[model samples]
Target: MAMDTPFDEFLKEWSDNIDKVRTGAGLLSKIRDADVDVGTTPKTLIERRDKVELFRYDPIAERSVDTPVLIVYGLIGRYTMADLQPDRSLVRSLLAKGIDLWLIDWGQPGRGERWLTIDDYVDDYIDEAVERICAETGHEKITLLGICEGGVFTTCYAALHPRRVKNLVLTITPIDFHADVDDPALHRGFLNVWIRSLEASDIDLMVDALGVIPGEFMSSVFSLMTPMRSIAKYNVDLIDTVDDRDKLMNFLRMEKWLADRPDHPGSAGRQWLHDLYQENKLIKGEFALSGRKVDLGAVKMPILNVFALDDHIVPPNCSKALGQKAGSKDYTEIPLPGGHVGLFVSSRSQGGLTKNIADWLTARDG
Candidate 1:
């Protein structure tokens, strides 16, 4: 209970420095040796179209759900997130729960894809994928499981062609983009406000000049949303996990996923930032694709809206707005604890999220 002497304090400082050096060396060794390859769950490529590829996962369990679920990930990031690792994979988790799973990979859009608009994605790419899944499964209707921006695509597709979708599942998606104003919390919805602050011409200029929005550019913008955490992750946060291989591997895997963001097509990028983010078109029932308006009321299929309680990119309110606007009499909203990506990767939410989705789809499979 007495205060430490100068010698004792010096010894403590020296010991701490030694521990830091050892931890740093261990981290470096792991970084050099660790297999950080993501989206590793075994899957087969079933179809391909230009930059998009559709994959069907080999079943790991007896199929309980008659309808197949097609996961649609936005161009901003790769679908590898859903299967970041065997232990924390949403894809594997759902598969283990006896769900037939498929995913659409919007493979790394390049300069050549600059002219591709959202219409091309929703009406062409997603529609073609859905049709292919249907034909393969021999099911008249397949479930659409869309994540983030992909959720908007599925929503549009569902609203436009309700009969094609048996069920609609959206995770960490934004419906009412401007709904962020309701909370105005510093750590949440910064992306929405930032996009809204820009002029339409600003969006146009950026898209026109770049041809395609660079993945690094969007990653930087996302980092800006939580500037402090983004910086600390490499130093303070990483050091805490250096001594634990499992924990350190998880961190490295997540970093691997983040580093693999794909460029978004220019026209689609423009519509996303300008029409949706700036104009707040989707919820207003004004967002259109292929010359047809996307009316939320047209989303009459059973809807499962899973939102993160602490989502910084897409605020909870923005996602929750779907429950009220969707035409489905059977609308469900799940508010899970985590930020945007954590909803899929965090161990705390993975079990419940997958179970909820599996159960929801199972209930409606008949």
Candidate 2:
């Protein structure tokens, strides 16, 4: 055979690329239409309120730790992401480590819930759930693990009822809203910049008009934050792993979680934006859960603050501030290396971050 010409090589390479695209399209179709099962880690519903449900995951190990963990997710997202898939599940990893986990599923809000405020969430729902978990586990105080805005709730609860929380864990949670205001490195944090840009009247008008912030609206905002994410990342990533079934499914599972957004209650949304985002009341010790001021100094329980170094939704500075503000004598701030969602599902986080949480809890496990 004659030596292959440059033109021949170029044609062959182009043809190979075309074949990959065709294969990727077929895989994408299956992902779009296939019935994919997620949040398969078994959990039992322990309690239910209007739209909130408390789910307790059975221990995968023969025995569980003395103190249990209660996972509270952000209001705008489903808790299912914590247990998205067996292999990539924070819930699974914790359970396998004998850590009993109870999750709060703040179900989709309705028109009636529009009047519900953080007072209702923290004083009523979260308190009741904590009581239920304590009763079940025969432990007076449970480890409070909060994710994102849920972290705000837990922090409020810990301050209000410090005796009820044995150890507090905040993952990608913002403690000081204005902590990164002067940090050029964290200027890319879209949520921080976007919220700060809005005037108080603008926030009030939006919440008042919508009643509840539409889940679709919030999801669209998230998508717009990084336009290339919606357009380029998926196409490039899918192509890279088009022939790999497991990788494609992994991607599809994450997409499913991101799409599963929940409507935030109007009153709560108004308070959150105005008080925490706008006024920076949380760090200033001016935030009120119901009628009482939430004092960060009351967070005396052993605390673990896990923040992603590359987080844009809640900048690392916002999360790291917990170490300085909380009253915990044993406060630890873990600086991770990813964005908000990546902490739970990314390959870099598979065993690393989850193990860190488990070990931290275990060290203080009574």
Best-performing candidate as measured by TM-score:
1
List the pairs of residues colliding in candidate 2. Answer: none
lDDT of 2 by residue, 248-305 (tens): 7887787787787888999999988889888899999999876899999889999899
Best of the candidates, lDDT: 1
lDDT of 1 at 123: 92
TM-score of model 2 vs. true structure? 0.94
* Predictions: Cα RMSD each: 2.0, 2.0
Give candidate 1's error at residue 17 in angstroms: 5.3
Tally clashes: model 1: 0
After best superposition, candidate 1 residue 307: deviation in angstroms? 0.5
lDDT of 1 at 154: 94
Q: Which ten-residue region of model 1 has the weakest summed lDDT?
A: 26-35
lDDT of 1 by residue, 234-345 (tens): 8778777766777878888899899899889999999999889999999999998999999999899999999999888898999999988888999999999988999999
List ranges where model 2 is wrong by over 4 Å.
1-10, 28-34
lDDT of each: 0.90, 0.86
